[model samples]
Target: MSYSKQKNKIRLNLVIALIVISLFSISAGAKTLTDLADRKLSLPDKIERIVAIGPGALRMVVYLEAENMVVGVEEFEKRNQQRPYIIAHPELTKLPVIGPQFGGDAELIAAQNPDLIISSYLSQAEMNNLQAKTSIPVISINDGSPGSMTEAELKMALKFLAEILNKNDRAEELINIFDQHKNELKSRTSNLDLGMNVYIGGIGNKGAQGITSTEANYPPFEYLGLNNIIEDDKKSNFTISKERLLLENPELIFIDQGGIELVEQDLKREEFKYLKAYQENEIYQLLPYNHYTTNFATMLANSYFIAETLYPEAFKMLEAKEKANQIYKQFVGQPVYSEMAEIFGGFKKMKLN
Candidate 1:
């Protein structure tokens, strides 16, 4: 071979080696993350398409302003129009359905061609099975209990999701907003003992129930340091018998609008009309915060309304609708208060006839 030809051949081999190295680097571009389920997953460095499965999974994505990257949604999410998040982003309903509620159909999820699958409230084994079936990275997240606005678990979940979606700034901003609301609520009602007996009824458990459905340690009541009639060691939701409710006989009764119809029907009974709240017309309605899971923003807004209602002089300047609109806008990028109010009668005193 000529000397110049030999030199050209060596240069060509060197260029070929560099090309191979570049390809290898591209194939290995992934980051390991520990999800809320404590599963270690290697995900692509830049994830452009994702599908959220289970309750509150898609809401986290929407919270981070990464909804645009969602490729598909659960059938339940598409059908449930009552949630504030869905009301704000109706386009999500237009996305292809991955499957039914809770966990999605693996085949349908894989068909979406998503780079990542976000699973909430799924066990590790379920997540592993999903990932294995779809050949996609699955990250499980927990959003704490439904209707809790200030739980640490929720904050951590948001941070973890924000990290994966490159939305750290948004996560911090949201966290700050939540903290501000918490502080404001605490400050507003920290002092002054009204010694008022309160009860929140018509809470949704598996689904909507009548006026007997109630939550122990209800978040809004706890936030404002109000005295809840139902006391339990563990925060929970359950139904109380009409006799048990009469025994407690709380001074003020707040109904969750989700089950307002059922509650209204219950009030028609002669037995319920004997309650102190019924006779004094101290019943009111609060926007429902639990749909698929907790709508943190709505829950927070409820606290303000409750405070304003119980201690009007303290919150005299706080306009309930305006404050609710601000909170909804911050969380979902839309002023959804009007829509929510339209669907579930806005904050108002209930007239038991």
Candidate 2:
């Protein structure tokens, strides 16, 4: 070969070596994360922007004070929703709707150019599909089930997710607030047996699910000394027969605002009218906690309200409204208690008569 041709061939080999090194370095420096689902994934070291899907997924982002990181939301979060997190972060309602859960559009998610995707809860199959379709790393943080977590599963989820987001300080502050209030509520009502079998009727699971909708082993009641009659009969969420309800005849029944209308409708029924709580008009209003997943702050506030209702003497110093405001302020950065209360009654006894 000519001398000049040999020199050019050597230069080409050096260029190839540099390209290979650069690719290897890029691959080597990638960060690895094990999400709550226990799925191992290699992600960019820096997660700048994200897309959140599934129930309460976007709300959890707000808790991290990381709304700035969210580039898109699901269709339902676009509205001026009642979830405290949604109410606090007005910017979320204006973001692009990446479509619904179960069938998120990868093209739409790609359009947002998110570096990560956060889901509140997703079946393993759903998680695999989302990650595969978008070619984006997806993490599921659960704080929804009682079996999954103590008090609020979302609370554990927040701390877990915050570690991943490098927001541990903020997560600690949030957890402290939850723990402090929960402990306070527990301390006062721990010993007092209100001697009352209570039923939280008119519970709304997804939306206004009517009067029959209720939670078994409700976290709020568990914190207080109250015994939920449903505790012995069921595990999670299930509607009880009105005939069975009449047989149990709980002394107190608190209605969730989400199911207020349905509760009112149920009150019109003669069968429901015969119940002890309905007869005495013990139905009171509580903010909806299950909407958009667990409203941990609201759950605490409602506990105080219930404690006060059952033992007015013990909680005379406490004001459920004030407590709700403090919790909302801490978690949401805005005390949206009044706004929510005005829309839906707060700790007020219903005058069904």
Candidate 3:
């Protein structure tokens, strides 16, 4: 071939190469996707910088053992600054606090350099605003409901956490353990005569209001195969009066943190001590601090304590300490065996009279 002809062929090849490169760049740009929550999101192969916007989401990160990757946390971090685990990580405590969905410093969030943001139950508008403010991806998960969120939701969230953190194995393992334990609990309680008189009592001195039988409190009662005895409160996070509570006389009373304090003070009055729950000793306190904080291990611990107490004969094989450690390793990725041992050290074993 002549030299001029060879040069022309080379020019044609170069033009084609440039066109292909341009197309590839456009395709990559097209992939900038948004999720159901509408937070600007891109599913990059890995996540290194994470921002958790809700207390529940933050707790999930702690459980998933991805605390190191967290770049920022919301206002709750400030409230929990003095909390032992959080205090140990001074950097997290020092990070700037952001407001909730209603209002937050969007510019401040962009400056933090996050690769992804996790939220729980955020409205579409709030999500869109965050996406607009940052180039990072945002994913949202639903908190478990009294009976609404099934195992599927847990696995779905786990898969999302795993994929985002690049720890698929750990997520699968954690999910499997929960499923296994739940099934075991069901089998054990299948035959028990779990009374339907369930009551949620707060520790306030003035006598806390009761949840109407319709409301769902937590997973323990449901997981243990016990029937919900309390009537549902029409509104969420409601308060009840003493007159209504006396009428229900629930067989089982589960107290949130500070609940027992109220009980202790109120029951001291001669008239209050005479109530059936007080007299029958059906009341039990939900362990403090950990209950509201969003840690899966804590939830599991709560579940075990409630189930084991209510059906001691069936859960004879359960070693609460060992189970707690399994959850810690599966999610927290840290062996909290000794630390948790202290936390659960004083649990009073339930005695069925």
Which one is best on TM-score? 1
Model 3 CA deviation exceeding 4 Å by range: 1-46, 81-91, 94-104, 143-152, 203-217, 231-240, 262-271, 288-294, 334-346, 349-353
Q: After superposition, how far is residue 348 of candidate 2 from its true place, in Å?
A: 0.9
Can you rank all candidates by lDDT, best first?
A: 1, 2, 3
Q: Give per-residue CA lDDT, model 1, range 1-353, as digits (tens).
A: 34795688467545533432332222366777666665666888879999998878888898899999999999998777888888999999999999998889999999999999998877778888989999999987763234433355567677778777889799879977987887778778778687879999998766787998888878788778876798775667778888999999989999999899999999999989989999999999999977666778888888888888998888899888889999999999999999999999888898778
> What does the lDDT read for residue 235 in candidate 2?
54
TM-scores for every predicted model: 0.89, 0.86, 0.70
Residue 72 C-alpha lDDT in model 1: 94
Error of 1 at 32 (Å): 1.1
Residue pairs with clashing backbones, model 2:
143-153, 143-154
Candidate 3 lDDT score relative to the true structure: 0.55
- CA lDDT, candidate 2, residue 135: 86
TM-score of model number 3: 0.70
* Model 1 CA lDDT for position 285: 94
Report how far off residue 149 is in candidate 3 (Å): 7.3
Q: Distance from true position, residue 349, model 1, in Å? A: 1.3
- Candidate 3 weakest ten by summed lDDT: 205-214
Q: Which regions in candidate 1 have their CA more than 4 angstroms from the true location?
A: 1-28, 143-150
Whole-model lDDT per candidate: 0.83, 0.75, 0.55
Q: How badly does each model clash, as a count of residue pairs?
A: 0, 2, 15
| lDDT string, candidate 2, 223-283, tens digits | 7856777765445666778777888888888888888887888888888888888888788
